[model samples]
Target chain A: MFKALSVREPQPACADVEALSETPVETLLELIDKAQQPPWVGMRAASCLIQGHADAVQDTLVDWVQQEDSRGFAILVLNQIDTLPQPVAIAVATQALAGPYASDATSRIAKSTNPALLALVP
Target chain B: MFRLPFALVALILLPGCELLTGLLNGGSGMLETRTSSVQSQDGIATIDVDVSGESAFQLTATSGQLLAVEAVNAPDGSQPLYWDDWSGVNSLTSAVWLEGKDTVLNWPVRQADGNLSDGTWTVDVAVVDDQGYYTDDQVDVVLKLKDDSDLSTGTVNARIVYADGLKQDSVVTAGVQDAVTRWAEIWAPYGINLETSYEDSSFSTDQPFPGEGSEQAEVSSGANGSEITVLITETIDGSTDYYGIAGGIPGTLDYTDHALVIVSWLTNAGGDGEFSDDDIRLFGETLAHEVGHYMGLFHPVETTFDYWDALDDTDDCGGQSACESALGDNLMFPYPVCDWTSCTPQDQLTSQQAGVNQRYTGTL
Candidate 1:
């Protein structure tokens, strides 16, 4: 049985932000799953994924949003996707807005400066 | 020789028309008036008005009111300010009365109704007889209000991380929620509300107490500029003496950022075990106290200076025993004791405390 430890400090992510960009998509997905272990680390991983592998990260986030157990974390990830490249970020945000996480996705998209992303808001 | 103004001489002589015959006949002699230099401190104005050859004098305000006497120079140790409650009035009229001649009447000026603001004001001093007759020889004194901004409102987001085993207990979750609710109610007047969430962790139960080694670094990691992160566990380094510990001094960056509370200690402090009413109350108060520090409130006597909480109304007990007796129920007191049936109301936040708390910039 895992001992219950309430850790207040942020855990060191599996990889640093710079190294996370070069890390493989599978590793990034695993880090996203680590959101259950320590939420902040997962948030940092998601940020790295959005900066590094936007397209793959977008697809993974959309899939996570589709799942019942992972939807909350996926919404948090989608919120961080604003830093992604315009076209890829727009596609991920559009899919998120069309899914169960539409409200959160719409809010994130509303903050974008890209016309296509802004147009998808309504 | 320089001559006095006719109007001034007339004012001195006429003395409210009724004294005309007395002055002409030299029946009661003449009234002499002298005012000292005015002094202002902490939004209060004080001055000394000396009157001789008059039975009594009345201090009237053109804008503000003559509040309580903060100090006096009288030899008899008599308080000059008198509070009079009139039958038909809703407010008490406070005034400075001079019973005899050659006494300096110290007057403190404060806001009256909505007339006082951040500017200079003039107060009128007139002679009054036993029959309510007022003299025309009125003197004007000036006062100024201090410039301090009003208090503001803020939001707190509290993240409660429980040990994995404790997180499974429904009682723990409910108790934590109740505690947060109580804290919100206590701070609602200050415009502070704790938005709380709980999480279960898989880390080891060997977490260090706050301010020891890496614990602070770890705990503060979850903290953001706008919210506080509270780590609740079964015990704090397995100590029962302390129910909760916060990081840093009040108004500092570290203090506003993180707090660690031990739920087990709070619950079992009186040997009643978990989920008891006393446990819930203690838990809430502990959280409130720690967060109070996060919001920049120091223990009334814990500061480097003597007996300072920066508020005038809250009592200051110089030492531990005195505090336990006189200020035992103060929320910011050093330690609190409780039992299963009832607990002390150590949860009250004074208005000045609330003002200091609301001045922090850590709101969402």
Candidate 2:
């Protein structure tokens, strides 16, 4: 994952994100915490976690959504997810409606392909 | 030592002298454009351009073959200039040698003293490869000249392409349109008006950056005519880290994949993942900067500090602090100079820089 994220070209670096979906939830969380370079690794890691271990990292994702620093990455993860669980979808829509990032929330909701998340968007 | 065939003659004449003089003396800064087509026989085509007292002049040559501006001759047929003249080491020796189908030659040609190489200029175009000239290649050469009545104004159109579902209508205040408005204001000082139109793309939210994959080329498939294409996507190359990238240094206006300017949605959001006033400002700068590259302007000085662009007005200040203080305000400076609090405004363009931008084939 480190090697993959370190590469400058985004195609390979981002392709590695899909492979990391099989990685352990704890390992993925650790990688996200330590990821810095390329500036998008944390967001990609969050995406990987959401894709493979949504139930396991659900609370952590919710917590990230509420925080200012990590909220963008968390929202980006939600934006890419093919299927958002009912609870996570409700939590994100509520937080998005009542935050400094309401515009970002609206943009994400408008572009989301997931019907459940789209239905939840106000 | 090569003489241009007499068949080549000036297709367009200069505007009236009084109006031109008034233009130089702060009158209406309208732009005059002349376009002519020549058929290459035995791999070479030549044309002549007549110049008067225009404030600035730029010539663009486009063909389907690998193209190069073989030579240029002054009106009096003296002091002929050739492709080999530019070493590209300094302002005086540098030139815009675009390798693809489209190429441009801005007048003045690196003269720091601002000497315009005006009046009956002869230009030679030829098909060539790394090995040698390709004589059998026959193609149509389209030459365009943009003559600015004054240094104060010019205009170029932009075609904005949005990835699937990312299209923000003209009324959308917070997204691409707002940033484009800021982009226009940044160029207003140079008298370059960036007129714009919008389109929708069938591509997904996350696609390859320009030159990364075929998607960008596909996105640009709809591009036609002289307007530049700007593609807005959620993430380029599956990552939101990149601010934007241009397909070429002086990207072509003809409809080809290599002629694209792309921006990332998340990268435009800046660090906060939300569009603040500062982020919007940065977004606007990025759009202008990237399009500046597409229009053939290099960084006044690269991030390395040792290298510099081919312009006289821009200083060659080396090291971090000196470069930051000297060139941080220029539009084409590499990377924004920012602290934890704020970033410096990069909105200035030297006369030569603006000349190059206006010289682009797309800058109508």
Q: What would the TM-scores of all predictions be?
A: 0.40, 0.64
Best TM-score goes to which candidate?
2
- Model 2: how far residue B112 lies from native, Å: 5.4
- lDDT by residue for model 1 over B233-320, one digit each (tens)? 6445432223466542232222212234333332222221234565566567778887776555666654221434545656755654
Report the first chain's TM-score for all candidates.
Answer: 0.67, 0.70
In angstroms, how far off is A46's CA in candidate 1?
A: 47
Q: What is the Cα-based lDDT of residue B130 in candidate 1?
A: 33
Q: Once superposed on the true structure, which residue ranges of model 2 sit more than 4 Å away at CA?
A: A1-122, B1-66, B78-81, B91-120, B130-136, B168-173, B203-226, B358-364
Candidate 1 predicts chain B with a TM-score of 0.51
lDDT of 1: 0.44
Candidate 2 per-residue lDDT, tens place, B30-76, comes to 33445556666666666566766554444555565556666766777
The positional error of residue B185 in candidate 2, measured at the CA in angstroms, is 2.8
Pairs in steric clash, model 2: none
Candidate 2 C-alpha error for residue B245, in Å: 2.0
Top lDDT model: 2
How accurate locally is residue A85 in candidate 1, as Cα lDDT from 0 to 100?
A: 74
